[model samples]
Target: MTTPNQVFEHHELLYVNSNNQPVYEDAMPGVPGIDVQPLFLDPHNGVWVLKVWFHPGVILPRHFHTGAVHMFTISGHWEYVEYPNDPQTDGCYLYEPGGSIHQFMTPETNTKPTETLMVVHGANINFDDDGNYVGILDASEIMVMLDNLIQERGLEPANYITPPQPDHNTKVRNLK
Candidate 1:
């Protein structure tokens, strides 16, 4: 409905100053000894970004990824139980392809918690040590859980960003 000369409005950039976001300790149900700070959520594309701090000696459930994941270690150390010799330490970047399965754990010997920033696409299908399916976690689920936890605990609201929804007025411009 616009002429060739018409100028379209540009979408504003979204930002999350993670320092303003509250870290929820043991926020994820059934996952203890970890603190989470959601930085962004894209429910439409099943993507979520988080900054997680894992206390020493904590072991996360084994999980399979439905989509790829990128994790960058910020501090301390952690490793998959299956790969004890390949520890992920400060500044380490790890990428997991879709369908990759692993159990995450922080060694009991660590004096401090391990922190990492993770960008996850799609859901994680979790399983117990016996290989029994436990649960699934995705962007929508995390969004809901964080919201609830913030309200229940009277904590500061998380500073996370979500894309603006497309509607009839949405326009796409091809810029070469």
Candidate 2:
């Protein structure tokens, strides 16, 4: 992010919001936070790699990405909707993508808490092109569901605290 043309390095550590609360939960006494850190922002490629952390029993509201959403579960018990290509074929997966619209939930796993690393490209940037909305080809079709997803966007957190831990680089999911 130094310069638009400068080479991006992986060493620079960026800690995104890990502890965030919904507007409605502000008055609550106890509440966990969801934080995200953008590790890489390559202007040259218009790409972003972010590390997302959710406290135990954290449930994320339903939402769709403006751009391609890529994710890899580092550890813990991560769960999501039924992806078209479910690895287990049991209709359960943490890495949900391909514009699948569904409410997602992350629960306490016997393993370490789940840490997801994701790459979302061209999310809010159209610096080049005619500011074209490349998130989806036809906004008309997807726009219909946008309202519902936006309504479910603000989800209150359950009162709880999960200590932050080193971002152990676990294997990322292979999304073709």
Best by lDDT: 1
Over 1-176, each residue of candidate 2 has an lDDT whose tens digit, in order, gives 57464333455444444455222221111224455443444443445565556556665444444456666666544555444233221222344344554434555542334566766544332111343333331222222222233356554432222223335568685556
lDDT by residue for model 1 (1-176), tens: 87576464757777888877788999887768899998889988999999999999999899999999999999999999999999999999999999999999999999998999999999999999899999899999998898888889898887788875655756576777
**Which run of 10 residues does model 1 get worst, by summed lDDT?**
164-173
Give the runs in model 2 whose Cα sits over 4 Å from its true position: 1-31, 42-46, 81-98, 108-112, 122-176
- State in Å the error of residue 118, model 1: 0.4
Relative to the true structure, how large is the alpha-carbon lDDT of every model?
A: 0.91, 0.42
Error of 1 at 77 (Å): 0.3
**What TM-scores do the predictions have?**
0.87, 0.40
Q: Which candidate number would show the highest TM-score if scored against the true structure?
A: 1
